[model samples]
Target: MARTLLIAGTASHVGKSTVAAGLCRHLADRGVAVAPFKAQNMSNNARAVPRATEPTEAGEIGVSQYVQARAARTEATTDMNPVLLKPRGDGESQLIIDGEAVENVGAGEYYEAGWERAREAARKAYSRLAAEYDVIIAEGAGSIAEINLADRDLANVETARFADADVFLLVDIERGGAFASLYGTLELMPEDLRDRVVGAAITKFRGDPSLLESGIVEIEERTGVPILGVLPYDDPGLPQEDSVSLPAAGETALYGDSSEVRIAVPRLSRISNFTDLEPLAREPGVGVAYGPPETVLEGADAVVLPGTKNTVDDLLELRTSGFGERLRTFSGPIVGLCGGYQMLGERITNAAVEGTGDEATVEGFGLLPVETHFSREKRVERVEREIRGVGPLAGALGRVTGYEIHMGETALTGPADRPFRDEGAATEQVFGTYLHGLFENRVAREAFLDRVFEYAGRMRPESHAEPSPYERAGALVADHLALDALGVSHENMSERV
Candidate 1:
């Protein structure tokens, strides 16, 4: 059986995902066969991966696990994330077990009727992964000390028991209560699980590490736990795990200000797969901003309508807020992805399938000459499409790889240019596609940015190559973390063997 290390956080957004990912990369770089696991996750940001039981079929897993798999240098599989819960508002979430969609259930219903099944699925998945890998880095959700839900906390408490894992607690000093949070978390943790805590690490420190020397020593003496490391507050530009990372409504966040070109993204109430915009945001001169529907589209060189969990509801909200009209009048490059693509069409039929109302049909923004029809079946698959070089993607000719996870079908209602071989519709300045990671492709991204820069009458910034995020993360952990304390050798595994 593989050794398990549970990366549990003191609280939500305390850098658990990043710490897990960094450790995965660090171990993999030492030639250790490591795998990432998350028993359960609640996030709208999901990625399609191969199903464990049926390798030929596509299944969904949380984006953090998918990214961690990459960091570990292994193929992403549904076993990495056995159970996923995607929130859809109204105190309900769509439950997916073993990479397949089960149903939408409220919190009470899930705990009462679905919890056992989810736990069983997680157990089987973990067993499979343990049998294959030498080490499994498991990530916990939220706080490990949520005593109110301890019995049903699949990702943290239950994982600790079932996996017999050693826990590494992570505390975020940026939140301004590092010692108190760590002490409180250890105190509140179930006694059995608390004893499993091997060490604790404080993350997101801004200033000199020497300043925390006294506090770290005091905490260690009090809790009898070693302080593993104090990681600096540097982002390696990894994809965010959930909507909590997004800017709040009525707020605008701008990333990268060196360039005159700016692309505006309206923050959908239930935005999913917003990682598609990260690659563009990484560009030197280009700026990507997320704002509310009412004001985001104004004064932007280009616009990208991101994917949404509930398209019908978001479209209705946009129309009522007059965002649809603002979008129609703006004469810049406009692209919509997935649910956003559906919203760009003339109308959507069978809308009741994914909507809150009984309406059979709904009007789209009419940016594209296409119509969409909602269905019970959803498409979730990794795909590679040849760029047709139209609209925003003009002059970009090559294949781009991405995934599709949507609940509707779209067909053209009038003449329009095809953005991909036979998928998506486009005009001179408007484009729509079901492809989720479109901008990740260098050819496609450069092409789109070139168009946007031209429209804004600004020169495109020179591009520079950088290290891969996995490599950077590995270096970060290896340099700062005390691997010896965790029973991981600093020497390469291959060399030691």
Candidate 2:
């Protein structure tokens, strides 16, 4: 059986995922067969993993777990994330058990009835992985000391207990209450669970480590917890687990030059698979700013509607927030992916697929001459399709590769020209497709950006696509953490694995 180490945060987005991923890489480098486990994950950013039922194809898992598995040099599986709750809207989410979407459930009903079944599923998955690997690194969700929800918090307390994991609690110094938060969390933790915590680490610190030494010493003396390490504020280019990690709009200028092409993405309430924006954000001379609906679309070269968990609800949100009206009036290059693609259609039928409701048909943005109908079956597959651009995007044509995870089928309502042959539809400057990672393919990405640059009266800058974000993240984790005290030997670390 494999030993376990659980990374629990003082609160959400305090770098638990980063630490866990780093540990997975560090341990793998030691020639240990390691794997990552999360009892539950609530995120829209997900990746396809190998399915146990179908060994040849891929199934869905939280993106963090998928990336962690890659860092560990192991094939990702649904067992890594047993319960995935993708928030739809209005206190409801789609429940996924072991890579399969089970049903759309409300929070009240889920806690009252569904949690036990989901928890049991997680236990079984963790047990299987424990038997197969040498080490299992588990990640916790939110604050581990939320006494109100502790009994039901699968990621923190239940995971630690089930896996017998040595716990490492992480606090974010950037949040300005590190000492108090850590103390309060430790004090609130159930006595037995508190004993499981062997150490604590401060993350996102910005300054000299020696300055924190005095405070760290005092906190350590008070709580009897050793400070493992103080990680610097370095954006190691890992995919953020949630929207909370997103910076406020205009926090960083999208471009240094006023003439550079700037693209605006509406920060939808239920945005999913946001990694689609990462590739575009990495391009030189292009700035990607996530703005709220009404304001984000103003003064931009182009607008992109990202994937959403609940198309109908988020679309409704757009209407309520006046973005739909703005989208209709805005005369600029527009792109929609996945749920966004569904929203640009004339209408959405079978709304009950999103939840238990009588709202069967919801009107879309009517930007494209297509209609969508939701179905019980979800289309989840990796695709490599050749695409040719149309209208103002005529120059943007190439072989695009991406994965699709969506419900509903989109069909043309009229005799309109299709984009990318039969895979997508477009009209003038407006385009829609079910493909995420639309900008990751260099050929397609450069072409689309070139069109935007042309429209904005600026030459498209050279592509500076760097190394894989996962490799950079692993290296950062291995460099930042003091592995020796954490029972990982650094001697010949790169050579051992």
Q: Give stretches of model 2 more than 4 Å off.
A: 56-58, 247-259, 352-360, 389-399, 416-421, 465-467, 490-497
- Candidate 1 residue-wise lDDT, 1-497, digit = tens: 88889999999998888888888998887789999999999998899999999999999999999999999999999999999999998999999998899999999999999999999999999999999998899999999999899989999999999999999999999999899999999999999999999999999999999999999999999999999999998888888988788889889888766357889999998899999998999998888999998899767999999999999999999999999999999999999999999999999999999999998999999999999999999899999888978998899898899999999899999999998877999999899999998998999998999999999999887889998878788777778888878655535333332
* Candidate 2, number of clashes: 0
Give lDDT per model, in order.
0.91, 0.82
**Model 2 agreement with the true structure over 1-497: per-residue lDDT tens digits:** 77788999889989888888888887776688889999999988887666655656766788899879988889889899989988776777889888888888998898898999999999999999998987888999999999999889898989998898888889999999898999999999988889988888899989888998899899999999888788888776666777776656434335223348788888877888888877777777778878777688778888888998878878887888888888898777888999988888899998877734578898889999999988878887777888787754566666877778998899999766676667778888888899877787877777678778888888776655576666666676667666665554545333332
TM-score of each: 0.98, 0.90
The superposed Cα distance between candidate 1 and the true structure at residue 239, in angstroms, equals: 0.6
In model 1, where is the ten-residue run with the lowest total lDDT?
488-497
| Candidate closest to the true structure, highest lDDT | 1
